[model samples]
Target: MEIHGPGGISGPDRPELKPTEAQRPDKAASTDKVADEVNISEQAQLLEKLSQVPAVRMEKVEEIKRLIEAGEYETSERIEGAARKLLEEL
Candidate 1:
């Protein structure tokens, strides 16, 4: 019917609660004042730029799909051109 614990609600035996150095408001405020920084790699920056770029032409994509379906997308001339371009890049 009565509550009794280590400190007995309020007495000298009751352990005082205080914030640690890390938990103190002043210490926490100083840590919050530090400026956060972020570094983006060149590749990531390029990717972000690419994301903002307009999407590929749907008409051109549809045309290529139609040609592929008709078995006419990979002709000899196109193959030769692709080979030439690959060699040029290399």
Candidate 2:
């Protein structure tokens, strides 16, 4: 029993088969790498902006501190007010 492939691709004459590295990457590995980069850049930019706006978080901090100092902090009231205002603005 002898085998002969067309165009001279006979037994032992063909090159050894090799898997290519350019094939589709491992989906989970690629997604994790991209997600890591995105998280790093997002946190970096957020910190930079927060640093530049010295008064941004300060205003919020002052409001909270004042409430805490005066014992006027009401969680439900603030939440409701903020939710209502947000809805109105939207």
Count clashing residue pairs per candidate: 0, 0
lDDT of 1 by residue, 1-90 (tens): 344776356656557889887776673344445678999999999999999987898889999999999999999999999999999999
Using all chains and alpha carbons, the TM-scores for the candidates as numbered come to: 0.42, 0.26
Tell me the tens digit of each residue's lDDT in model 2 across 1-90.
355656556567668867677675655664344433434688898989988876657878899899989988878888899999999999
Worst 10 residues of 2 by lDDT: 30-39
Model 2 lDDT vs. the true structure? Answer: 0.76
Clashes of 2: 0
Which candidate achieves the best lDDT against the true structure? 1
Cα deviation of 25, candidate 2, in Å:
55
What are the lDDT figures for the candidates, one per model?
0.84, 0.76
